[model samples]
Target: MKKLSVIIVNYNVCHFLEQALTSLAKAAKHVDVEVFVVDNNSVDGSVEMVNEKFPWVKLIANKHNQGFSKANNQAIRESNAEYILLLNPDTVVEEDTLSKCCQFMDEHPDAGGLGVKMLDGKGKFLPESKRGLPSPWVAFYKIFGFAKLFPKSRKFGRYHLGFLSPDEINPIDVLSGAYMMLRSSVLDKIGLLDEDYFMYGEDIDLSYRILKSGHKNYYYPETRIIHYKGESTKRTSINYVFIFYKAMIIFAQKHFSTKNAGIFAVLINTAIYLRAGMALMTGFVQQTWLFFTDAFVMYAGMYVLVNFWERHIKSDSDFYPPEYLHYIVPVYVLVWGLTVFMYGGYKPLAKFYHILAGIVIGTFVIAAFSNFFDAYRFSKGIIVFGGMLSILALLLVRAVVQFIQHGNVKIGDGRKKRVAIIGSYEESKRIDELLKDTHYKLNVLGYITSNKNDVTQKGYLGYLEELEKLVQLYRLDEIIFCSKDVPAHRIIEWMTRVDNRAVDFKIVPDESNFIIGSNSSNKRGDFYSLNIELNILS
Candidate 1:
């Protein structure tokens, strides 16, 4: 038995980290393995939890957030094991997942790294776990709507294939970082992951390097792991888009020819700017009416109302100086615009309260400095009052616009499609729970069970034979067959029986144990059901 060192890098993902460790503990029971958890300055009590619950595992706690590559390298350098598994903190392993992966690698001498099938938390196959290395042309095609135009064509939609058979092991150019099992020798030859990448694309870069060194990367679907993907950074405030693009630039610079690298660099930069432009445009259009209203209110109130009132009604008073008000209002508006721009306040669709708070802080700072320089000549109270009023007016206009647009529809309105699940009570209940927890847009109309053991307390409309009657009665938009208790073929037959009807259909993908390839074709007919046959494998 070859010893395996499992290295999991943690960065404030305590909940997922604990589940991963627990899963690994169960999986490693029959294998010789050492777990190394490199904590990247996680303030979420992950270090303390690991220390308390998994004391036997070696823990390297870092003082700062040393990213994925550096943290994994730290563990890899410290271990003497023949194989290294770079596992994510958001993944759980089956009891035999590691052992099977190790066995496959041991048998395949030319393999540098092996990746297993990764299922999402909902048990759906994640296609990116197995993929081809993205070339510049492929990137362009994917980005420019070519892939969506011809989804089934290999020339266009070759990147994402979900329906591949899960029983076969195949070679691939790139493997996902979620559950990459690397040979220790390959790491020694290619060196550790490029630290230039703080997080994303390091996996692909390393896999490409291994392939360049005459070693193959394998996607072994026989072994599987549950990856709660993106659980760590999904809600983080960090700019991952910027980070990923930066990594791509670093990779291109390191590996590609000078000319090619420069072209890709320009292309990626242009793409980023274009996207930013789109975001700005979207914001502009969304706020155009409101912006105009607020501007008109401010300018008209100051120039027309104030100037007219001060000039005609109180002409003899110094308190109503027309020239002073004219210069002061324009200067104030200019200063406010500059301050907002400098503080990144114009970033359209910025909804965070912190950003608004920053604008307030910027306004106050400007007002304080301007007042101090004037030697109390300008009224500090007036500046503060004016700034507050401006911000309040802007925010109020935005609030009214948002209310008008978003408030038109009620919460839980039928705009989101209503789905009716038909299957055993247990399976339907489980699906309902998942839908409820994830806030999935589907509405469950309850289950239809045939077996006495499948009777559940959650809810039940009828039996499996009553699917047609229920569909007509509930006016369901979609039917999801949970194939846990009943055979999938039977459900398919049932669907065929009602194929001519207007109802849309989908399956739970629990039974049949079939991983549908990306190129699988589905045909529906009066006497036949959803027939899916895999035709291509890449």
Candidate 2:
């Protein structure tokens, strides 16, 4: 048995850390492993909890947050294991995950790094875990939205498809950092993660370095891990977008050609500006409304809400200070409203880190200006602290409201969508296990066999002929057809039968042409004709 050292870096995500450790503890029962947790000065009592609950694991508590790369490096340096697993604190592992990974690496001596399939907390497979290295063309196409037009194009979407198959072990250019299993030999040859990356892009940098050193990066889909992902940064006031962009710049400077780097920089700046512009517009509208309400209504509506809260909870009357009632609250709201608009806060689907970063940057700007102008007669520390506190509270309140409105707000819901996959038994079983282990937003109702009874022994809902009745009976929302062993016409027929019904129909793109043309959008013309132009051929 090989000794595997799992290095987990924590930054204010105690709950996620606990779950990860619990999973690791269960996994450790079947393998020889040592877990080392590098705490990046989390104020969330992560260190204390770990010390009390998991004393068997080694814990290194730092004074301040040193980012992911540095913390993992700290653990790697201290550990004396043959394999270093850079595991995220937000991930959970199955009992045999580490053992299987180790065995795979041992068998493939040329592999520098091995990454298993990573499912999000919802059980949905994360595409990032299997990706090709960033090329100038791929980067440009993706940034420009051209890739979206031809998502199936191999040349255009090579990076995302590098790990499409769940059964086959394949060579990949880059593996996700969430659960990367690095060989000590490769680390010795190529070196540890690039510390310049404060948060993002470090894994890509390291994986590329390993490849450059003539070692292969393998995506082993035989094993699986569940990554809760972004819990801490999503909940905090960190400037993720800036930090990520800074890391991207570092990566571009190191690896990309001057021309490529220039293009990347331009694209990144454009994205930032576009985001900032939207945020500014939204903030302007919101501030205008606030100003009118504050000026005309004498803040009556605001007082009503506050009074309601106070009446219900008598002790929380100090929630909104009367001092903020004059002009302070309005000014704060106006600045951040504009700041958030400028930073792309209105794009709810944007990365949480980016949004949080916007908040942090906005708060800093307000604090800095107030300090310089001597606007308020208060200590700089108190003013800055209070502003941060207020921003956090406001953001939290907004998040709660949004959650209530959406009804999709579950901290650890991991809601799995019940799905009945129509494919071969072998393939379906593999897909079934993959889906079961994933933290994606899907649940496998079970696998349904084809007309041939290939999966009769494996237990299925029914044959393909009875799929419609099963769909109606089970009330399935989605149907996925794996096309490798199944006929395309059968899938089309099945889709046609389910067409216009409440269920969403999707097919696994296996044909080369279909894969190449996956993301292409069709349009209406004077006389409709098929357009077959490849977007990435440009």
Q: Which stretches of candidate 2 lie over 4 Å from their true place?
A: 235-238, 275-538
| CA lDDT scores, all candidates in order | 0.66, 0.66
The ten-residue window of minimal lDDT in model 2 covers: 520-529
lDDT by residue for model 2 (372-452), tens: 655453344434444455445445544554566434543223334467877777767666665544334566787777765
Q: Deviation in angstroms for 237 in model 1?
A: 7.3
Clashing pairs in 1: 163-515, 163-516, 163-517, 164-516, 164-517
Per-residue error for 60 in candidate 2, Å, reads: 0.3
**Displacement of the residue 205 alpha carbon in candidate 2, Å:** 0.7
lDDT of 1 at 352: 31
RMSD to the hidden true structure, all candidates = 12.5, 17.6
